[model samples]
Target chain A: MADEEKEQQKQGEMEELPVILQLRPVPAITPVEEQFLKKFRFLKAWESSMPTELFLTTYAQSVRVLLCHGGTPVTADTIRCLPSLQCVIATSAGLNHIDLTECRKRDIAIANAGDCYSENGADYAIGLLLDVLRQFSASDRYVRQGLWPVKGAYPLGSKLGGKQVGIVGLGHIGSEVAKRLVAFGCSISYNSRKKKPSVAFPFYSDVRDLAANSDALILCCGLTKETYHIINRDVLLALGEKGVIINIGRGAIIDEKELIQCLMQGEIGGAGLDVFENEPDVPKELLAMDNVVLSPHKAVLTPEAIVSLQDLLMANLEAFFSNKPLVSEVKDE
Target chain B: MADEEKEQQKQGEMEELPVILQLRPVPAITPVEEQFLKKFRFLKAWESSMPTELFLTTYAQSVRVLLCHGGTPVTADTIRCLPSLQCVIATSAGLNHIDLTECRKRDIAIANAGDCYSENGADYAIGLLLDVLRQFSASDRYVRQGLWPVKGAYPLGSKLGGKQVGIVGLGHIGSEVAKRLVAFGCSISYNSRKKKPSVAFPFYSDVRDLAANSDALILCCGLTKETYHIINRDVLLALGEKGVIINIGRGAIIDEKELIQCLMQGEIGGAGLDVFENEPDVPKELLAMDNVVLSPHKAVLTPEAIVSLQDLLMANLEAFFSNKPLVSEVKDE
Candidate 1:
């Protein structure tokens, strides 16, 4: 009778453990994630030798939480497959890849990395701006190529102080970018969906108007239906020659083809870009341009930022299982 | 009799006009110098086909002011050549190019570019720091080299937030660097000759102590006898493996030879150097290292800064001729 009672209790304890579903492994983004996976167990769909469809159908019947990130698209099809899935946890600040419409329609709770990537994103955006205005990498190449004496005097770069900088989105990343730029004596104005009452910076309802007033334009908004190709030829023309554009937001937010054309025609001064429309495939024309600084979509990647992302993911998962609200939940618009 | 009197008055007016002796053409530094030369005439020694010594001996004998910059050194011999030289007007901020001891011994009033270049110098210093820590230039190289897709994922950079930065000199440039870093959420400390009562940041009189506690060291101090080679092998050792060094001051402040050796041995992480121990001659080893960023000692050269320098130089000359206190005069140490 004692043995039978012990067996029944063991089975009940196994049922109590919450299962988290992952389409792919988390270690793809950060190396520190593997050890943390042991602490917070995730049922990785990719790990199974069985077909992903078969595994999802068999194992995710009672799964309530799905863990994903900006790289992995959690589509309507995937969400519909998991009948019991009520929550989605993303490990990135940007939610463009998460199929927001599907999440909203199903009433599934969503949590993102929140402000974990804000500081790093802001640091990088400003870094790119400085690199472009200062011609840092171009000059570094000149020095490394032993052209100093031959060149006589390096070209004087445009000054950063007292420049009018326009920030797009003015969300976590944009706001943080503003903080750093103010210290450099830059005046900031921003554009967003709606004017924020708490913000003191001048607001421009139209992106083109912001470009007209700015010496530089820094993109920090998310990719959305309205925001896609938000920065087109009209905006570039408004920014004008000697107007620098730094993009840390998604690439499609700008019209890539038009931006290249503007740069080729010398309509815009320069650009500092982290994200591209089709990443890993940068325009060949920009590769030789000294004014343009290109980075491989690494603005939000940092060692400390990864740690913060992990903490945020753990916090969201714990809260959901405990029958509490997510820490940084994205509400339906 | 009337023509003779008119000639006498014209001679008196020509004598009243101040003569400025230049060892070389100021136009070599800035193109604006050529236009300003006609307004405030400078006797260019290089313009004469005659030997510089012969030109100085003949024309500079009665010249009361000398115009020089960092590139054209006003050595003890050069100062000795001009017996009537009462003032030295430097277009550059740092007066290390001019022999300070010789000037002081001869009782010659010296006026440097004052705070004209401070904003730009600070902008460059912080820009170098951000570039070094955030790997802005290195990543740009990767993207430009078409290695993004081939590399899969670029390496992560260190975060700027909460980093402990040590300023070697708390002059105008260092103060600006601190202000910018604070906005990025970094803690700052400094090592100067004496701690200012007004500054809230922790100060270390001994630079070695500062190196032990800091993640980065920025050299913004003037190149003095005591400050020369301030950052040596011992100091680099204390800064440890991950420490970064940015020099916007004179190149001699850090032992470039030892810095290269440390960087090679992985004893220190990286360096962002604008001024090298020798001009136009950076260590060959640093040219290949990804962590090292080299510039051609043009940190203080900016479009707006050149304008400011001309204004400062003009004001100092006017004040000196009027028997008023020389503006931005460097006090004798």
Candidate 2:
């Protein structure tokens, strides 16, 4: 969990074990690499005494699969060094860190964390939403500060039931969030690029329309050109004075400056943000507000999700070795 | 809302309207007395210049309905003054406030909150459990204190999915908690006085055994002679160092002293306590711990739940006057 920069190697003595090449450690937060060591040997470029370029060239002809982490970018230049890399296994759902163009051009197959973190992501979104509506974090703070006795009853929080909650995306994670919110009796509508044929939740083609109707807008969409600063001033105003926003998606998906202003001006009621525009460095203004609950981009950092991710990564690697179709192949766009 | 000690009147002009007698304003936390004003007239004793006993004596023959709040006790002495008091309508689920013995002796019907707060209770229970398991309060605190960038990553939290959760007293609130947790993929088991005949959830007659098998124990049972201090040191030990305790039930259902020691000694994983044995005066020790989420017993204080309670109270009063069986009348044991 320390985010160690130095890439490491494990399991050297096994003679017939399958090998997976790594530019760096996959997912630096969890020390789950120890689990991976038992089944597959890692040929890490960062562990080499030689330069990384030289290390990659050494394995260029033989390396069939490459393991990529979110922190480490899989650049076209690096991909050019490996002539026979068949597939790229990613530790993140977002392909921003991995060069999809390079992979697509090379005809290299890919497997991201496909539904491996859907449950965790969904759970966190609802958790943040609940925290906002019920003022759980605020109540916890009042008690922790020994102010409960001094400050009488904390202000009453609104209920999740009978509230109209709109989801920003309705993909695997968004759908899971919708399902959980349904259990709380929240009516869920959603905004995706297009209306999902299988999803019954009412869909909005525009973000502004979704914000206008929703009591809270939970951001579950990925950050992209179309989605950058999607939650801007207009959306925040539409969400209104008593509305809340819970972001489990990328931080930049929201217009952070406008969000901060809305929170400060009480244009919006409250926010439960797991991701920030610049993670680790939250807005100074938000720290003082009891209405807002901030987290350091830890939506997918649950133990069960980690285990599932490890399984998915292992399965993808094994699938490549066995010449079987990948279990969650990233479809070619 | 302030806990107003002075009882006040809302309406006086309505003629031929049915009167519901109030010893005090029902449920002091919400100032929603205005809604009650439109329906019925109140014969409030506190508003009279005469002594309270004299006020009751004047209306003894005509005052057929009595209203009670949680803070205002309707003792046997008071009930004796109202010979025609045919029913007692309480603002709380617990009947300890009104003289249940006196009500039963006179065959006076009683209606408590019943299932009015059930949905809110369940929502808060799951919310607290999710807070404990996922460390939302801790993560929020870290970000609020400007520790995210300095701290890098918050510690990984355990997932709710695939974990065994045990409910203590699978009643109305407990059932709702089970329904929500199941949507999150949590396996639920319960321990009640007897296994619920209609419920398919695995049952344990003993609390200790339920704690031993559960990753978390959610206390949703009512506090009775059989259940007071049901969760003691032995139960906490059975729950073990990795198990969480979520108290949505009465505070005394758990032995506060033993729970504190468990949390302090790391005998239990954590706790999400909404009710403390001594509320408004939570133990100082629990205030400093990051693992515990302490709330001021606001589980059923949601806006929607309040409206539901208002409707239920009105329905019960109307039912009593219409010669119908009370919707949520407390059964004589």
Candidate 3:
């Protein structure tokens, strides 16, 4: 017993010190997410919203790295508070929230899980399309209201087959959405910044022209300064009465006031939205209309997406720690 | 001007024909639906609903055959009134609304478009499955209620992949539903009066056992005296908490009161209903729950289904007129 106690004490003395760092709340991470986190032996994981002071005090110790997930923006104050922080890993495609210039000045190696959410976003885009075309959501409401034996000309729903679908962005998610739409017997076309030779679909140089021709327009491109409020009143009006616009991209990509105006004026038939500009606070005007289907910014919260993101984040972390090329790096451009 | 006056007189004669059976309102009809009617020398075409007397008087004269569609039941009085009616072609699967006994006694041939609606029903079954499993409808409601940043631990929705789906019937629509469910990675099992040699899926001898084991139970069986209210309270109770029930068949096949009881007591998780016992007027109790998804008795009302049904009906009518064997004749078993 005495020898065992002495051995335990020696083992404790040789144990490595813990690395303390703040980890923000991520979407439901699966077993795969945990497996990736297991590699960081010296790090402490916080799965909830923690105060800045607590994070700073922890960073003052052995912590040299911090991780954020779910496209959370890392403010200048967050970085300034953690003096010892040298690395920031964000498990999301977009890094708009992170102050990259400050990170570069602080010599912090930054990486994000880019394009990992493409499949999830595309899946959601298809779901929204089906919901709108099939009138599933509206029918559900009607049924719940004891309005079965649907009034007027019953079963007036249209088939998704043989319709022209216009994709606003032919990026990772957009391309995937296009592929799925094709499977449903839809003709696909798109509008992108630059035309690509790889895609088989016809490309329109202008968004208005694309909208004017398409039965439905899907927004799946990344949000940028130039692309902000890109789908405005003129573009919506151009799409005309038979068009439906589905925004799975950033909400800022659409002009809310203009969209509301067009929807009210019957310029567009319907819309399916996921993300918003100032999220957790959608426009009351949009809610009042029955022609739109809205969702919380949870298009990328599927179990598959969570696991993929975790795997990508771990891959990035391993490369960073070993002084190898990071998996997903952001360029200044 | 004399030629034009002659043509107008001929057109007026054609318009005054006695037989005018209005089919369901559609933007257009397939060439097949119009084939039999084109052969009828005295019949005229109308786009509106027929008055009771006009319908009966037409059947008494040039309208030896009457074609019906949609859910309005043909009463015994209506059948008795049509003394000269030689045949009734119902372009629908269910015959509960049609007085088959009266037609049989009068030696009138009765045919219906049955199997053609199977694919349509299957499509709707999958739509409901996707709607419930993906929480598509629930999420829409949440967004509409101005509930942003959906609070608490959101319920984890299960993927259809690798789950067991039990079909209550192995008939045309049930089999079709099974085919689509299999594509979504579901393991299929079914309960039928007799085992089907064509299908490779396991057949359960008992309905209760099938209900107990299935993740989701889909009803696609026909309504008959022997099978009425087969999925009663006990069968539903056996399904337990995780089970989701979908009814694309006749609502009489399920005990509505018992189903509602189970839903209210939380014995079953959810249900997707397309028909009801006393339809066009759903039970007030069922309308109170958010767990259930509802659609009017219009599952097979798709354009594809409509076109197919009309074609089948026309073919049957042509065969009857030509003294050939009917394609889908109603048999007294």
* Predicted structure with the largest DockQ when compared to the true one: 1
TM-score of each: 0.95, 0.90, 0.76
Number of the top-ranking candidate, with lDDT as the measure: 1
Report model 2's chain A TM-score: 0.89
On residues B210-318, what C-alpha lDDT tens digit does candidate 1 reach at each position?
Answer: 9999999999999988899999999999999999999999999999899999999999998999998888888788889999888888887888988887778778888
Best by TM-score: 1
User: What is the alpha-carbon lDDT of model 3 when measured against the actual structure?
Assistant: 0.73
**lDDT by residue for model 3 over A25-137, one digit each (tens)?**
65434355445444553333454355656746654555666777645667787788778777887776666668777788898877766677676677677667766666677
- Local error of candidate 2 at residue B78 (angstroms): 2.8
Which residue pairs clash within candidate 2?
Answer: none
How would the docking of model 1 be graded?
high
**If ranked by TM-score, best first, what sequence of candidates would result?**
1, 2, 3
**Model 2 Cα shift for residue A255 (angstroms):** 1.4
Give the poorly placed runs of model 1, Cα more than 4 Å off: A1-15, A28-40, B1-16, B28-39
lDDT (Cα, tens digit) per residue for candidate 2, span A1-333: 333422222223443467788887666424766666667777878879989999889878778888887657889998899999889888887666677788889999988888988889999999998999899999898887878789788888988888999999787899999889889899999999899898888999999999999999999887767899999999999999999999988889989999999999999999999888777788899999989988888887777777778788778877888899987787732
Alpha-carbon runs more than 4 Å astray in model 2: A1-19, A27-41, A48-63, B1-19, B27-35, B46-62
Restricted to chain B, the TM-score per model reads 0.93, 0.89, 0.81
Quote the true-contact fraction of every model: 0.84, 0.85, 0.38
Q: Show the lowest summed lDDT stretch of 10 residues, model 2 chain A.
A: A3-12
If ranked by DockQ, best first, what sequence of candidates would result? 1, 2, 3
Q: Which ten residues in a row have the lowest lDDT in candidate 2 chain B?
A: B3-12
